[model samples]
Target: MNTTSKSKADTIAKLREKILLMQGFKPAGAMHKRITGLMPVEQAFPNQVFPLGAVHEMISEGPEGAAACGGFLGGLLGTLMADAGICLWISNSRSLFPPALELFGASPHRIIFADLQREKDVLWATEEALKCEGLAAVVTELNNITFAQSRRLQLVVEKSHVTAFIWRKDPVYLSNTTAVARWKIAPAPSISEPGLPGVGFPHWQVELLKVRNGIPGSWEVTWSEGRFHTHDETVRKLVSVRNDVQKTG
Candidate 1:
């Protein structure tokens, strides 16, 4: 490309980003507010801060993967909902017992679980939930989401200041969406803290595959103390960069 073409392309990108900031969407530079109890994730985001009030995603490939993802989110919600009080959990997975969430910090009473049968109903319910300012958070499980649907949720959450977590199970398929972040959660073997013979706190390989206006990450972490702790400090900032490198080299 010529210098003139390259310059024009750069200018357009800057203008687009500027418009997003003007309209109240988070910019990659200005960042956003940080949420409490996500200690290890703080280092993974830009400026050593995590973005709150944004939609996040978790994907898993199998039953074991889905369970691992749920475990991580349950632990996360415990910290996220401590001050907010009420939370709404929407999913078709009857297997997700409310009592299980108590194993984390969020009590079943504080959470309102909506068992929606159809995908459309789940999405509809989730969007309405996000519009409520009284709720601390809304969690939904689905197979996929379109860019348009995600944008609608994003706009609503921006106004309501409610955070949303969308869990897409059994699909490694990636699609474009307006979510602030996307993560892949899979179970990792745990090592007991007290050298006991039984299973310790849940462990997971949490991969921050995408973060809008921020960065991606790969973390082997354990859920303890009501939050996530780093299992390996060596690898970080994971995404397409590493994949592309492998393909070429």
Candidate 2:
């Protein structure tokens, strides 16, 4: 064979090897399917496949703020489901506002809100949500979570091929856990037209505090008109305080 032909064959062989490795590295018990495309994050930052078997920690400051974060994450998960799937929201503090969730593109009917009275119950329900294959994703609001509990939840999500979203009231140090990513969500000032008067409802600033296999940094995201989009520089600068908290805390 010619040298050029032999080199082409070698490249093809290497590509096949990489594909095989990816297939094997996928979390066990996950059923592989042909996903058509990913949801849109922004023109600059495209949406990515939701990592299976790994906990995705989304920390927000309060109940209202957590709901905003949960809504965005939940909508992303909802877009991935082939059919309308159950979205389990496990919380001990407050029930999510349906109207606010609608702003994030989540259908109220697809969501199941479970209000627990204690932390133990919240964790137990979160585990159950992770185990349920019928669910597309599970969003949990809690004050505290231990590494051991996170590990258990991760295993369940892997086995069930479900996404687990933990919305914490405050930031907590996580060590010895298999979380793929950790995010801090905060409210950002709304954008306004040059001639327009009066302030508008605020947007959100999403900072990826930690990502196992992706870029980690601040991304200004806003939920408006039933969609999530990246923010402009002015909006991002206005929300510098939230970014500072995520960076320093």
Candidate 3:
């Protein structure tokens, strides 16, 4: 074959490989399916539970609280994506802290942060990003969002099979809605030794205020070194002290 013909054939082959990856046409079936049967929660979601490929909404009272919630959720989503997919962050007010996020298994490089000015623009851009077949998940921050807009986002996520996370500045009062899960995160107790302490940030208290197919109510979670885990009573006391310091400071 001539040089030009050979080059053309190679290019075509690369294109075909790219197409296959986008379609998830692997030689073997999905690994998740094989192990999911052993997990009850995974069965409940049917569409991949927790932060995997499911639409979730997180609402916080203020920017500081929202940062904690966002970082924790980002890590969860990042851990789910691992090296196989990318996480999109569409923010209007705050920027994602790379070092903090990296602790949760999100690679700073894999995160794509986009700053948008208007609420409508943020929603529009988020919708477009969710439609991308290549992304593992998309997370967006919006100061205001309506039920109708949320429903539209849900439709796009369902169609594309991409997980969407919406973070709002304040609580959204939707009597009836289509969100798969709704979470409210707050500053909880810190996990630290009471007497043997250096200066560090406070931990978090996460509550699953609403979940479509899962149990809801309070869930105590602590954050440290970019990782989130369940908080025990001992850690809870530490967090209480930390909370006091924060309040006084």
Best by TM-score: 1
lDDT string, candidate 3, 1-249, tens digits: 699999999999788767744533322235442221113323333233443444677878777787778666765676557766787889878655766766666777887888888877888999999888799788888766777888888778767878788886675564445677677778753455556677444456666667664566565665555555565566567667778877998
> By TM-score, how accurate is candidate 3?
0.70
CA error at residue 82 for candidate 1, angstroms? 0.5
Model 2 spans > 4 angstroms off: 1-48, 77-82, 172-176, 232-249
Better of 2 and 3 by TM-score: 2
Off by over 4 Å in 3: 1-48, 172-176, 199-202, 224-227, 232-249
The candidate with the higher lDDT, 1 or 3, is: 1
Q: How many pairs of residues collide in each model?
A: 0, 0, 3
> In lDDT terms, which candidate is top?
1
**What is the model-wide C-alpha lDDT for candidate 2?**
0.66
Given candidate 1, what's the lDDT at residue 13?
A: 85
Q: TM-scores across all candidates?
A: 0.77, 0.71, 0.70
Error of 3 at 233 (Å): 6.1
